[model samples]
Structure formats: C-alpha cells, structure tokens
Target: MSLTSVEALTQVRARTLALVAHLDDADLERQVDPLMSPLVWDLAHIAAYEDLWLVHRYAGEALLHPDLAARYDAFETPRSVRGEIELLDAPGAREYLRDVRDRTLQAINGRGPDGVLHEMVARHELQHTETMRQAMRLGGLLAPGEPHLDPLTGPDGWLDVPAGAFAMGAPDGAFSYDNERPRHDVEVGAFRIARRPVTNGTWLSFTEGGGYQRREWWSDEGWAWKEDYDITHCPDAEAGHPDAPVCHVSWFEADAFARWSGGRLPTEAEWERAATWSQGTDPLQAVGQVWEWTSSWFGGYPGFVAHPYREYSEVFFGRSYRVLRGGSWATDSRLATTTFRNWDLPQRRQIFAGVRLAADPEVN
Candidate 1:
C-alpha cells in the first residue's frame, strides 16, 4: 500500500522536531537579527503554514481557530519582528502541530493527491528546513557530526561544460514562482564557471590585499555599502580561511571581488546555463554547496505572468534583492533543484551564502 499523506506528514514532522533536539531554549529563541526568525517562531510558523496552505486552503478544511487565520496567513503580511509564539509552548506546541498534521493528512487521504497542493507544501516545508539550518548557524551550530563536504569545493575536478544555449526556466505545470515564469529563452554564450563555489581561501586573498579598501575594486553601490557599514576585514574572519566558502559578503561585495580579479559575476542566464549544463543526463545537482550569488537582479522576463506564488518573487523586483543561484547546505534537497532560485537584499547576509567565480569564454 502507498503511504498515506498522514504518514508522510508524520515523517516530516518527526524530522522537523528532531532538529530541535540539539537546541536549547536559548538556541530556539535566538534571532539572527531582522533578516531571520527565531527558531521557536519558525517551527510554529511551519506547522501553521502547512495547516493553512495544504489542509485548509487546498484541501477545503476548516481552520483550527478562526482568529488564527490572520496570523498564519503571512504571505500578505510578512512578519518583521519574531512575535512571541505562545501557541508553540513545549507541550502545547507539539500537540498543536500533531493535531494540524493529523487533520491535514486525514483530509489529504480522503481527497487523494492534489499535485499542485502537494508541490507547494513540499516547497514550503523545504524552505523551513533551510530556515532551521540558518537558525542553527546563527546560533553558532554547524557541525554535521558526520561527513559532509566543505562549502567551497571548486569545479576544478568536475566535467567541463561545452558552449550552448539551454531552456532556462520552468515549462508547463511546474510549480515555479512568478520570477521564473513565462518560461523564456536566454542565449548563453560560451563561458567557464568554477565547478564549485569559491573557497574562503581565495576570497581572503582579495580582502587581505585591500579588496574592500580599494575604490577601484568596488562599484558605486558596493563602495557605499562598504563605507556606510565601516567595513573592515576581521583578522580572524571565519570566512577568511582557505577551505571555507566565502560567506557574509553581499552580491555587490562578491561582484567587486570578481571585478578586482579581472572577472565578472555571472548573469542569471549564464548561471542557469552553467547549472543545467548537463540537465537531462546529469544525476548530480549543482546546488547545495552554498547559495551562489548571481549578478542578475530579481526581475520578470518580457512576457511574465504572475502566478499564485507571485509574491515570492515579483514583489521584490527592482528592489534591493538580487538573484542567487544554487541552494546551500542549509537548504532542503527538494528545494535544491537546479532551477530553484533564492533571493535576498544585497546588504543582508545571514545564511550560508558563498561566492562562485565565472569567466567569459574568451577571457578564460
């Protein structure tokens, strides 16, 4: 017999709950500034979101609490402050989560599988998993306790990609955000991108050699961000190490570094082309090492049509955010698809972000 939605939900819930096992209340409550949420709030929000989107919205179930709808329906009103999640207090939180999961599964079992709903919930849950890891990192917890490759593995030993143009975005019926919509053709010229992301060792060279201090290395905006933040290299910056992937730098920062090194950041088209270079036959996804910052701004294509997930992308267009290709170690494998794109403001840095180098074919 096939596993029921309830059973799957149980499994997902178990995994989410397990993430908190190693975390104390302090860790759970800790906030990584304004960009991220407290783990306590994050966990509760995930449960509430599953209930709201899958169970109630798609499955046609009643809300557990009528008044709770507004709080849970945060796609319209994205939370800025990590509100106190009194509803998620220890025993009550677990019980509430179980209730939501069980009820949602029961509905799913009777209604059967809804492909769109399933995909959305799956993606949403995957996002939460990444948020959990970001929270862990913010809480100073990143030891895997087992084997996992470092973030900055360059594409040095990997297969070389031939020059070609490939279909970049989602086709029909794919659960893609609006930013990836109106699936368009992008011509990718021959180029060479590092197989893996840039290592901390490489990034440090630029920084230590006056990378941030030099005006020539920075763009107008990049220079402002540096000067405004009074940016200075930490002699003990963790990202300054050789093996670590360069983290904590903005897209502009990475771009400046790339510019300083006589290269340029990859465009969205180029990044996608490099990522899906071997799309049909390749088994290994090029994501999950780190969140690769692309030089592309988050914007709609020529004939873009907004979908239900429009807010996920279009709302932030022409704003401070930029396009980031590839998921990170903190990202869920489901969300780690080659086509998946993550975005944040240029100045914001909290997650496991790292830079990768791409060069023009002629330059290489």
Candidate 2:
C-alpha cells in the first residue's frame, strides 16, 4: 500500500533529523551564511511551523510554545540577525521538536488524510530539509555518501523546443505552492535551449577570456555589481569538478554569459516549456543538477489566490527577485517539481544557482 499522510510525515521527519546527525552543538548553532538560518533554528522551526499549521490551525489547539513564535518567524527575524536572538539550545530545541512531533502525530491520528493542511506541512518540512542541506553545504560539511546512481550526462548541443501553447504551473489536484497555482495556458515561441547546464570548463573559458572585466557584456546594473563585488572567478569553483555544473552565479552574471555566447537566458515560460515538454521525448538534461536562472521577474499568474501560507509567495511577488527553475542536488526531490518556483535577488549568488543558454529558433 502507498504511504499514508502520517507515514510520509514520519519518514520525512526522520530524514530531516538524520541530515543533521553528524553535527555537534557548535556546528548546529553556527550560522553558515547571512542569508540562511542557523542549523538548530531550522530544526526547531520545522516543528514550529508544523505545530502552527497542522496542530494549531487545523486541530484548533493552542500553540505549545507561543513565546517562541517570534524568534522563528521569518519576517520578524531576518536571517542575518538570527544569531543575535536567543534561541533554544541543541538539546532543548531537539526536545521541543520531539514534543511538537508527538503532538502532531496524535493530531494526525485523530484527523483524516483528506485535509490539504497535512500535505502542506509535509511539503513544508521537505522544503526545509533542502534548506538544511544547502546550509550544510555552505558550512563546508562533507557529503553524506556517494550518490547511488552515476551522474547524468547530456548531449553537446542545444535542444530544439518547438513553439506551442502549453499549460504552465501545477495542474489541479496536485499539491503545489501558492505561486504555482491557477494553472493557465501560455503561448511560448520556438526556442532552442542548452541540453545541459553550463559546465565548469565552459565557465572557465569565459573567466579566462575576461568575461567579468568586459563591461559591454554586462548590464549597467550587472557591471556595477561585478565591480562592487570584485568577482573575478566563480564562487566555490575550487570544489567543483570540471564536469560539474557551474553554480553560485547571479542572474546578471548568467545573463552576461548568455549574451557573450550570442544567446539569452530563457524566459520563465520558455524554461518551463523546455522542462516539461513531453510531445516526443524529454529533450532537456541535467535539470536537477542546479537551480537554473531565468530572464523573468518573480510574479503571480492571473486569478492567483493566497493560500494559508500567504507570506510564502505574496511578499515577494514583484520585480525585486528573479525566477529560477529546476532544483539543485541539495534540493529534496519532493520539492523539485517542474512547477516549483524558486526566486532570489539578482545580486545574490550564495545558493546553488547556475545558468542555461537559450536562443531563438534558427531561420532557414
């Protein structure tokens, strides 16, 4: 039999804890980067969110630790300043999480699996698991083990994606984030996208050929950012193998590279079409290797409605953030669906962000 909501929750919860099993108290407490929460904070916050949505909201119970809500609130406490806030220590946080989980299990037992909240909480925890994985990588933690399957390989050239009207975003009955809601038809023109992400070797060529120093190859804003940050080489390049996808690149940088290669970053629609194309066979490759940047700004579709997690998508629906499709190796598979939307500031490059070149269809 397929796993029930409770079984799925239990399995994901155990996996979340197991991801941090190697960390010591100091490691758990340490903030890997200004953009990310401390490991311990994520651990506790996962349970806290579960408690808030599943136990309290759905079950109509009072918050077990109402006092601790502000500390874990993403809006109330910015990630950069989370270290200054007083938080539960390792053991205490673990105990608090256990208590919340126990209560959540009891609540789940009483309730049926038809509620959307249960699936929401399960997906929410899985999202955090990906976040924790990113934190561990940023903190220079070692990989847990070798991947069971060999790394995927792709063809050398761009894949032809014929233009057509395609349904974008998640379809009905599928559990998707609010941002991917209100599935609509999008008309995408013919385009050719790279089969695989730009590899380290390709990026090295750009760097060696003075890609960063050439102001013309970059936008006005991109040039300013490049000079301000003094970014000469790829971030974390030392750790990347030649065949590994190049990551930690900003959208501006990716755009510059695309321009330099006589192409452009695929618009969000194009990226989605290329990613989800099932007419003949799957043309794209190396999708989940890294979060590929697109040329579209973060925004909502027509008839979009904010779900229970309003702040999750509503707060950032504007031009401030760029859309990134696909997921990285650090992302949990459950949270890496085709319709899943990940966005970040154009200047931010700390995440597992990368590039894919897209071009207009060739004329005969």
Model 2 regions more than 4 Å off: 144-152
Candidate 2's residue-wise lDDT over 168-243, tens digit each? 9999876888899889999998999988888877888888888988888999999998888787878554446767
Which run of 10 residues does model 2 get worst, by summed lDDT?
A: 142-151
- Clashes counted in candidate 2 amount to 0
lDDT of 1: 0.68
Per-residue lDDT tens digits for candidate 1, residues 1-364, read 1344455556666777777777666666666555666666666677777787777888888877666555555563355745443435545456667787777778777887676566666667667867767656665664455114364433353334566767878777656666666777777677667666666677777877988888998889878987998876633244345675666667777888888877777787887776666555342234576788888878878887766666666777786778887877666665676677788777766656767777766543
Q: What lDDT does candidate 1 reach at residue 109? A: 72
- Candidate with the greatest lDDT versus the true structure: 2
Report residue 340 deviation for candidate 1 (angstroms).
Answer: 0.8
lDDT of 1 at 50: 76
